[model samples]
Target: MESKTTKKVTRGRPVCEIKQAEQKAKLIFSAKQLLNIKSYSQITIRDIASEASINSAMIKYYFGGKENLFVELIQSIADEQFSQFEDLGEHKKPVYLFIRRFGEILQSHPGIVHLLSEEVLNKTTPLARAFMAAFPARVSKFLPPLIQQETGISDTKKAKLAAFQLITLLVSPYILKTLRQQAWQIDDTEIQGEAWAKDLYRHFIYGLKESNTNEVES
Candidate 1:
């Protein structure tokens, strides 16, 4: 019972949406490639558009501006990393599971730690504030339970400290990747493999034992 024009418009919408999604993805990918070589401040719209092989105006059309695009890219990376954590508690060895999944993310997103350090940890820009607003709640909600389960820590403060230590242990390696390679010849693949995760879990759990026993006693 639809007119030809109405049917045509409905059919055209899906194709338009698909094209828009493709364009946005290209822009995002372009930004990511440029980010690997350049700092966030140094990457411009033209650079991204040139990388993407699209017109420069499309960057604004798709992402509003360069800053927002970068923030969204970082947010997407955080979401990808965080999504891997959901199944951690379900595993028998949650700490090992967490470390392995953490490695997977680092493998998939090389230089992600550097990007995060440059854009979020080292700055107080609007992009940093936006990312902080969106992600910290997710981290707070997810990490504490895993930490408590692994360490058997009943006190909130001690559990928090353990979580901080665990994160530091996981992230510091990647942050110091170059130094780790130069000093020890430990490549990223070795760190991102099951062998390293097992070792890290053993050391971390062993370290927790003294405190866990003391906490139970006192």
Candidate 2:
């Protein structure tokens, strides 16, 4: 981890090395927790610092500001959730990946659901737009025609929509779990987000199987 203090590297020395994830994850985790209690706009640098027991300046040093920090943490969750899409080139079946990754997002900072209000989901913010834009472009590193192969949806628009729908279906249980918590009637543990995501994927893939495809030949 970089020092709590950023130092001038003597003459040509590189800027202080980036902090290790273990050292830094605490701050992220802390900020995530605080974000749950209040909207991102209501939460301040002081809140995050107090929660994490670190200096306010650390927020600036690590993330530059709250907006950036929220974006980064959300991006981090997306990374964990989409890792299989990144690895398997998006052409691979999503079911196997959805279960594991859905579990990952659940286990890892599922708390962020508190901050991710429906207002934000409905209204397009620059940070959210930037996140949405950058994410699938990388996935498109593997998506585009794989989408074509899968759904026979060749138009770029349709393919992207398919990707978004598949991702949404996989991740919706996190939000549902949050809703269940708000309802306060059921055990969150009993919700089974991962299994549900896998089962939905199973149904989706089974339904998407084409009549003229090789499976039909068999």
Q: State TM-scores per candidate.
A: 0.82, 0.61
| Over 4 Å off, model 2 | 1-26, 36-42, 61-63, 76-84, 89-95, 134-159, 176-194, 210-218
Give lDDT per model, in order.
Answer: 0.76, 0.60
lDDT of 1: 0.76
Worst 10 residues of 1 by lDDT: 6-15
Model 1 alpha-carbon miss at residue 191, Å: 2.3
Per-candidate total of colliding backbone pairs? 0, 0
lDDT of 2 at 202: 70
Ten-residue stretch with the least lDDT total in model 2: 11-20
The TM-score leader among the candidates is 1
